[model samples]
Target: MTTGRPPRSPSPSSSPDPFQVKRSSVARLPPSTIATSYPSSGHEASVYAGNRSITPTSTPSLSVSSSTSSDDTVLDESDDHDLHTALTSEQISSTIRNEFGYCANQNYRCVSQHNPEKPVAEDEIEEPPYYILFTTYLSYLLVIVFGHLRDLIGKRFAKSSFTHLMPYDGYAPLNSDFDSFYTRRLKQRIDDCFSQPIASVAGRTILVYDRYSEDFNRTQIYTGTTTRALNVASYNYLGFAQSHGGCADAVEESIKRYGVSTCGTRLEGGTCDLHRIAEALVARFVGTEDALISSMGFATNSTVIPALVSKGCLIISDEHNHASIRTGARQSGAHVRMFKHNDMRSLEVLLREVISQGQPKTHRSWRKILVIVEGLYSMEGTMVNLPKIIELKRKYKFYLFVDEAHSIGALGPHGRGVTDYFNISPSSIDVLMGTFTKSFGAAGGYIAGAKPLIDSLRMRGYCGPYAEGGAPCVLTQIIASMASIMGVSSDLVLPTSTSTPISESSVNEVLMPSVADERPLPSKVPASALPAWLSLPPLLSDGSEAYERIRRLAFNSRYLHAGLKKLGFIIYGHPFSPIVPLLIFNPGKMPMFARMMRKLKPTPVAVVVVAYPATPLVTSRVRFCLSASHTKEDIDVVLRACDELGDLMDLKHGRGERWPIEEIVTRSVELVHSI
Candidate 1:
């Protein structure tokens, strides 16, 4: 079957590097090079330089201190050589921009913190035109009707293929038609749009492999080509997914010293000093008393939640919480209940019902009532009403578990998640769960809470004695990234100014104590919490770069969300959320949207489309995960493509005021702040 439009032609360059992506055709973006100048301080810069040059001995010492300039940090010399060689002569004269895009405009930046004085009124979800909805229903109906007819004929005429789907010789069928219909029929029709392989870093731009389907997507034939596409599909939220950077450099150095695996579980001799150090940094980052790290992000919830509640305990969860949360809740064997997504009233009603009615049948009081919520919903992009939840928690005294998987490093001026965004004390929430995979560009998850609670979970949780500890490199990524966000303690105080790309005033606005006369010191990464051997550049070490990332992500997220709305496309979620979901009400439009966006002119774009099980049948959408690595110009490219395609596909059915795509692109800074 035809995948869509013919794939874009490959780059003219015949360079051997498989992962190098073509630069954008819309406009040439400036290179985003990290500044290498060291800050003048009492600490010697040579110390960090020495640390980066050390070779791993048979037994490495724990107290080694090292450092290096950004110019010298190279993970692979050949990779860099190949990358430069692949570029044209004109491009070779200038710096080859890394995956991280550059934008120095301070006007685009916005503080994500919520001001209680100005409560946010949720934007009403725009409805598509009636004709669009009517046609959408018709499309699904025809597909289902034709699918059943085809299956009937296939079973009657093609018995050999149907044998596994039906009982044969006293053996039960492998799968009934009812069980596999969606996967075998409806989903199979559009399978090519789902998992297209990519060859580059999942940053602002990605190199997507070009392919075509031979047997209705049963098999795909790679054309031995790739199209460089603007990436609005990945979860590299703060854009730490780079091949070259302070974080990457530190990770490479750590691999040399620690040699990857810790060799065992946390409780069975697998634990390293890095584990303890990372946990300490995590606890401090989230403002929790203590924390425990798990090897996998999914297992962090799936395994530990059972230890938190069971049997008579009640688990009140949001209807749209991640599957991992649901899996953990099921394993806990708790009496589970769900409230409407982000509906505080529904939550309150459910809390009252559970508190008043107690356990079902016996009517005995529940052993414990834990309310679980996501800091940001992945599909919908809505944030939990944290302030109101705190209000309910005070009234009902239920323990709260907030999963900050997407929000930890994406939200707030300080990048501290929902609690920071709303200016609520982290201590107010009973449990804080977050993953390193999303923003830190690492491979683990962490659960932070009271020291006693964490200590208890570490010993009793399912992951304690069985799961392998996080790899040393993964831990190094976490430590380096986290420390970058939480700058190292220093006497150098850069004066606050409005002209600065990331101003101290903006940081102060988010980090300001809720109470007057109770000034809290900024949460700086302790020098001792990091591996002594780890070497970071001045910007990463000082936390300036991370602050820029936080602001840039905030800008990109707001820009895309606002720009799409301006172009008259129905969308869902908060303006500040990185995950922007544009509603594709008609099922037929889902694949078309993906195809058009990917095959868009000059620069192809990668996007993720969701339907059915991930969302309601009617509300299929294309999710755009914005990143700090994207510049304003990158967002303009996306907006322009959406505008052109939206016109072609009749997707611009959104109501209210609309702006021309050109105007939206020009006035982006105003639009972001307005939103």
Candidate 2:
């Protein structure tokens, strides 16, 4: 936990010598007078000016030294009172120096004047520089003046005068009116205050933004004009999104052998050795009999859902499920029923109601029922209660489908998926779907389950012949990444399951362990103790190093979460997860908060600001994605910047009360005009 730096010591040049005191400047009082005026209480001391008590801000120290004789010294109350009253400020400061070894300041002035060259203590410093004060005052004045002007303008103009100039109201612009309304109003508003969206790639310690300038020719693509910035937006969880190492080397070799594109679907001549290897690895990793790979992560769910479920079936889904799943469910022509997000009780209630009521219009039992959920909710960063869901599945006779897009290779002891995290057999899940774009550092997705189900999809699925298969290079990257994560080389043989296809009647028997008995497995192993074949030389090096990366990532996430919470930020999700959401409850301040974060000094932390449609109107937030590549120092810097910005903008929760959008927009527009 130590930062590897030594503790700072006080400089000798700043401290004054107490023993070298000037006795001539101090006033002496009569001992008889002091004896009559001092109190009898040894510990309790008080000073009085006439009838009123004049208490010192701090307790004064008393030193008694008798000049009569060294042997005749009196350390009594009377001597203590005489010493306290007779000593000047400088003498008292000298006494303090002698005791505490530091100069003490009182009443906005230094008591000890022994060292004139030394700088004044921070407590004695003046206000901020003149320029800061002037600008602050000017800004306040402008707001007041411009606010009145906006009010006047509104009163002078009728409703129709500015109707066309105003932007759309509510969460999003109406689709029919968007072109006319947004082009003339919203576009201008954004252009005035926001920069154009630019693209970038991950580099060492920063994101490299590609830009065009006058120095480069118009047709030249390699102008190389770039700006480096701190990356906080990307989801490169395992730190595998690099130009070098095992993943890159594999990609290079695959490209040289097979060229760039597959040019056909998996059913045609597009099935290469890399594709077969990747699919086998995925099937083994998830503990399933088979898996089907696709070129696109989104299309995997969109195309496969319809192939499995259709019109006579019922699909019960979580309300906050991803768009791809929702789209696929709609296309399947099944009766879709949505339950509240992560609310197990709500889901149970719906199941009970549906079972009692039967199919719509016809009081007959439903043909088939399927329950779908995600391993991790992307927006809220919360995990689904898999054990509870499995229990519900058994009781209700419903098939379960878990999308491990966020949880695979990021959760569990072996990075297998959520099933491993809960110590449940993968056969318990009817269908396990996941994307390689996140943890695997590749572009593709897979649907793993029993061999029969996969074979059905390969033959009847729409994506088999119409959609292009994954590129040879991308397949190689996926295979290498999976092997490295499992602590094995490409040639190493792994343990595989020989279980038959999972059927509705055999669900309970196949998943032998009861839901009540299931528990989580250890999520990490010591990096140094891993097998030699798993070591990827320069990149992963050893198992200990790999373990350290995951550990450091979790630690950094918790550190940042605690810091943001301390600053009054309403954070979402559990402390263990790396995805942190800094909630901005006031919808109007979401854009302002994002702009402030980008303007932070030293280096800008790139955060994705999610708003309405993605989240509820008032629950918008800035999402921070932590990675193994980030250091503790990077986390600390971000925390400090966010704290300062939150306070300055009064955006922190429970600090400033929420204001109406009209008031906020009015002020913003006024400020913009004034600027």
Clash number for each model:
6, 3
Instruction: Show pairs that collide, candidate 1.
Output: 48-66, 48-67, 48-68, 49-67, 49-68, 51-66
lDDT tens readout by residue for model 2, 1-675: 111122234267532111112223112211110001222222111111112222233622111100011111111112112343655433332222211111011211101011224421111111333453455456436544664565457535753444443444644323332344323332232231234233332421343334333421222233443333456666666555654444555566556555888842233254654565566567656766558899898898999888777776679999989999999999989889999887888999999888777778984565567788998777887767787898887787777889988778666545566776566778788889999987777888999876657666886567776887788778777866665665442222112244234322221122222222223321222222221122243324223334443444445455565556556566776444557887755444555676566656656666677755688644657888776555444565567677777777654653324433334323432321221
Q: What is each predicted model's overall lDDT from 0 to 1?
A: 0.74, 0.55
Worst 10-residue stretch by lDDT in candidate 1?
60-69
Candidate 1 structure quality by residue, lDDT tens digits, 1-675: 111122234367622111112322212212112213333332232332332433234322111111111232111112223554454322221121336664545676777888788875554667787888899899989988998888899889998878878789999999888779889887887998998798767766777788998788878999987777778899998888875556777777666665877742233245666776777678768876568899899999999889887787789999999999999999999999999888888898888777777789987777678899999999999888888899888888778999999999999889999988888878788789999989989988999876557656877688776788888788889988898889986332322334233322222222212222223335675453355566677767777778778887888899999999999998998888999999988888899999888878777788999999989989999999998877777888889989988998888888778999889988888888886
Error of 2 at 396 (Å): 1.3
Please report how far candidate 1 places residue 614 from its true position, in Å: 0.7
Per-residue error for 277 in candidate 2, Å, reads 0.9
Candidate 1 off by > 4 Å: 1-98, 167-171, 264-269, 490-521
